[model samples]
Target: MAKKKFIVSALAGILVLGGIGVAAPRHAAAEPVSGGEITYGTQTDPVNWNPHQNNQANAFLYLRNIFDTLLEKTENGDFVPSLAESYSVSDDGTVYTFRLRDGVTFHDGEKLDAAAVKLNLDKANETPYSIYAFPNYDSATVVDDRTVEVRLKKPDASFLDSIAYIGWGIISPKSLTEHLNDLPSGGQNLAGTGPFRISSYQKGAQVVLESFDDYNWAPETKAHQGKAYLDKVTYRFLAEPSSRVGALPAQVDVIEGISALDVSKFKDRDGFVYLSNDANGDTFKLSLNAFLSPLDDVRVRQALRDGFDLDALVKSLYRGEIRRAWSHTSPVSPFYDKSLEGAWGNNVENANKLLDEAGWTERDSEGFRVKDGKRLSVRVLYPTQLDREQRSTLLQGISQQLKQNIGLEFIVDLTPSSTYLKEVASGAVHIYPSTWLHSDVRKSLNGLSNGGALATDNKADPSIQPLKDLAAEALATSDNAQRIKIFHELQRKAVIDDVTYIPLLVQAYQIAASNKVNGLGFINQIGSPEGVYDVWVAK
Candidate 1:
């Protein structure tokens, strides 16, 4: 899932109406009341709403309003307490103790306690679909009625950062006891102890969230206290980007994601402003399944890596707004290394030499290299959409370059998003474009390099082991300075040696909003429209 940027402009003073000090009314006849409606659109409908499932980040963003986590990342990149009032970690970092806040209740009116926290963490560990099911989490113990202790298998410095993930959202123990099975698989019974409560949810259409009147344990980091300013927030699903952009100018108050191509359309619109930021997300990349035949050869893989011009591709496809990446860690991220830029660009001579050394000495009638009676060919699968079309064109150009320079054959397969994930996971597709939304290198590499069922087999390439080890060491150590050093080394290795996933470009998130909308801010890491919480309609 791509992180949506939060864009907010400063306001001078609060609006007044009818001799009362209230925020300015955005629409006519509507007083600046606390209970009103705000409509927004999303490009894709989430597959599941269960925060435990690692399906999509956008779902978790919507879930964030409903669910509470132990910690949350503030705009300034600091981790503050959300549910827990204070926390202490062991010197060795194996144990984490949290003191739960008092006077908090879930939507169902259940008291939030340490036992409830244990239940939530236990459920996340036992659920098969959970992204945090690794052996790292040893156990969760209730130290007291309001205190919980978490034990880890190793001293992970990023453990608190991991807890900040949406997958670790706190749930009511009562809700879990009643709907254990439904809870993990994403049923309608969504409940949490956040600022808002889910009034109603339609599977693929929309979700209605109403403020929790009794809620008071909001994090100190949040600007609004007690009940949310808006009475109800309606998340309407609109998959078409153009349609999403169209709704914002008329009836919709705020829309989440605005692509680079759509940014120009809202530059001078009445009462509107554009909020953009260099996203902590990267463009989709071509993931080569190294286990597949022909690609399994190191020489062939290196040739493929050396044959493409990433800079030119980004310039042509993205209108030069994006920065070309040389490593999996995005440029805006903390782990980014500027010295590794363009580590793998077009080198036609090196590509041909690598192919020749790999025993592809003979060219077939179609000008494709062949060995052992098999042609050097593979299909590059991509999703069928306008944004995907741009990616496909880049792939097609790289394929042509490979064929002309090193006598390799390639084909393109365009499919729907659903079919694409299924095909890629099943190993049916040889090469495909995929993306990762990770602010920290540990989280980014864990999604791709962790040696588990979810680990990409591309790591089997010996050249990738050092990079994987660096990520592992970073995850195991508790020292922040040491972890940073290891992650930087991992970034260099990913670009200079591994060459596993081709880093393409860092995409800029574009948001065009009406001028009436104030307090719109940009959050580069997590891309959800809910960042609109700070935004309000101008009086």
Candidate 2:
């Protein structure tokens, strides 16, 4: 592989500048010293380590250490060179050509080339189960030993941002062929050209990683290159928040999911540092299953939205730690429509009027709204992984409010993470609670559109076709301003008019790390850790 330089086009500049979210990195005041180990405490363990196989956001926390994305995104949303030293896009904005950097080899000793990049794209296209799968992808061809060409079925401005994500990371073709079936179990089945390699994986317990000594490729935006400073990194699964917080600086060098209520524990504490940043992603929301009974009526959906006070509920639960979200994307997103603020909220009178207009005026013996002898009840499909205390409290409040304000009975159906997806896709539940981990608003909108991951049975429903069309248009538009305008229209259609999704809270990363761990960085868009490549232990 040989490195080649090329001038980026106007579309390329728009794509790079389109990344709006910025991340806050933690830098230690002391000088960096190498040769140490750092242990991290995380809430959930990834079931799969395969970059193309797994779509879990938690998986990226570790998978990023084992694989490298072709292009790296910066804190300010600029896509820089990494595995691909330089890239250029076609004038039509459908073809992308990447020039591979020379002297890079996977941990398994396989050399990286144009064919390897093509294979990864082909694998991604075939695997529809992954969120990173390119629905618009047509084909990938190897131009030369160091050049690869990717062709999309349509023009997609978000394509570069999508590839820069961890899910699109390049894995060794040999490893993918050998452990294709067992890649989900992880363990020793993974190999990549990242700063570190997975030495071992203990299911339900921990994952151990050792620095890749031969690694020299890093994004131009990264301050550190070559080998990672730390010799070893260990990630221990601590499902319980108390257990994770208990470990602290004594047992683990770093811990994630620290509650805002417990921020005092690490702030200004000896040998500990509290790190917090607003995540640049989709907000936690409830997707109303439009295919279901009464929900099929737009009036009923608007009534449900008007029944609850999301602002007060989020404030009460998060205690100002998290901000109330009115739209799908975070408020920090450059494309977020600020006009949506205060557009929809608690209105018992309006809720009653809407429900009455929908012919749900009669109340049953249990005081639940009844239409044509059927009670108005919503079955909420909740995932077990998100069954935290705060979420539980939020649901309780919603249930109480809907019951009192709108006469709608809220039935919670707690489902395990494994079966949750299947259950939600079955459309048996009236409401599905989830969030998208994408930094791009176009990707988030696509997931909510017809035939998307969150669309489920709503694919055939005509109501969401408008949203789907808007999402497609946004993806095709190369100009940032035009894309932003399209997003604004899409938001009004989905949140205000259709009321398909009810926004709740914007999630932020609350991490507590030992002062000894220095140079902690995050993925520019989602605020996820960008591995320990730059992190060094202070002497």
Candidate 3:
């Protein structure tokens, strides 16, 4: 269930992890010790445990530590062997062969084998909510106990990049039938081959992971190739910034995505380390439901895009901490189109003219545009947990600006993650805001074009078929140059020609860790924090 971001809320909750938050006795620094425990404060709990069925960034961020994919992507965008010791693709690119690592075992003690690989791939294809769909994926065959072959219906150049996603994370085959629905609760059913195992899960409160003592297989790129140094990692769900930062070196050893205001507190602090990275993924943007009245018209959509002053709104909300985005892809990505930067801006007069031309010239007593006795109003659907930063304030400002500038009413609808998914699927929302995860350009197009995950859940109009075809062409070819060209045209059609989305701002990941916490690194090129594999307390 790929979902949207959050809305405004008050900060009133705090977590109490027993025996955590107590400072250990300090000593002189020496070699990295192997047995220690640390508590991590993160934002959201996993909504679903089935990797293929959930696309929430927070869920994958945590699961990356619990599961191992066939291959691991390096920080420099190179692939290295993880579960699969080696892999090769055929010349035509329709077939792939993987040699599973020897002596590897899932947490449940099931030996890693070719049969497990085939079972995972086949199950992903059968799941409806799987975000990474290999339309060309045909079938998988077990060549031997440690060898497997995957045949595709057609050539897909992006297959390797797509398979590296944690959503394809291999699990014990028996759990598929035994504990399919309850994986979210995470006990013995949450079986993965990674360095950590779920010791316990406390729903929305916390999840405790203990190091797998027998784990030794690590990606070739990593220097450490043994069990996780930390004995235990307790992830406390702290959605509020005040509670997370307040825990600090006392209650939590690491806190994720601290507010920009909290960065100043760590700069001069002696025992803290603050790390920041320019995230590589989808920009925070809004998708308009074309099935709805007024929004179905291109003129109305264009008016909405140019109606608000995004530059001013971003400055006021982020306060120079984050950058404004003008395209669908992040500026950090090679596929980003610099030409779209100045192609559009805040043009109040032009927005008004466009709305007038769309037959919304009449104004009601509330100053909202009216046509056929109906006022022009849109409801923006957003989740509730994302208020950790200033996201709520940012959205409210945009709504107010639209009302003042174009005589259009923008209503902010804040709901829980469960309700948000249902509203998005019902095709009843007028506007949906989201920021998704994508390491490849084709994945970005999946959310922008018709029938994409981020696109409105409605029947695709015949006119948008060409846009969808461009997305398919980008994925079918492996040539980097040809793929780049296709992505440019696809973005132009979606943003400039069709007015499908309003590009917002680039996402920045900020994390703070105690000086005692060592060997902290990101999981992928997109830079989500790796689970406590190599991290150790320096004492």
lDDT of 2: 0.78
In candidate 2, how many Å is residue 182 off? 1.4
Candidate order by decreasing TM-score:
2, 3, 1
Which candidate number maximizes lDDT?
A: 2
- Tens-place lDDT digits, model 2, residues 131-240: 56777789999999999998889876777777887888898888778877777778666788988998888888998999999989887766676788899999999988
**Residue lDDT tens for model 1, 41-110:** 6655566666777545445547767887887665545556778877766656577788888988888889
Off by over 4 Å in 2: 1-18, 451-455
lDDT of 3 by residue, 1-539 (tens): 22111111101111000001111112224577889899999888877776777676666657877889987665555566889887776656677788888999999898889999998888777747466667778999999999998888987655666567787888888777688777756776889898888898888899899999889998865547899888999999988888899998889999887777778887557898777666677888887777676788888888888999999988876777788888877777767778898888698899999998999989999899999999998888888865446777778898899999999898988888768877888777888887876575556766666733434545476766777787777766555666667777767766777777788878777778898887765555465555668788986
lDDT of 2 at 292: 72
- The regions of model 1 sitting more than 4 angstroms off are 1-33, 183-188, 281-283, 361-367, 381-407, 415-429, 447-468, 478-481, 522-529
State in Å the error of residue 311, model 1.
1.9
The lDDT-based order of candidates, best leading, equals: 2, 3, 1
* Model 2 residue 14 distance off true place after TM-score fit, in angstroms: 5.2
Better of 2 and 3 by TM-score: 2
Give per-model TM-scores: 0.84, 0.94, 0.91
Clash counts for all predictions = 16, 0, 2
- What is the RMSD, in Å, between candidate 1 and the native fold over all Cα? 8.4
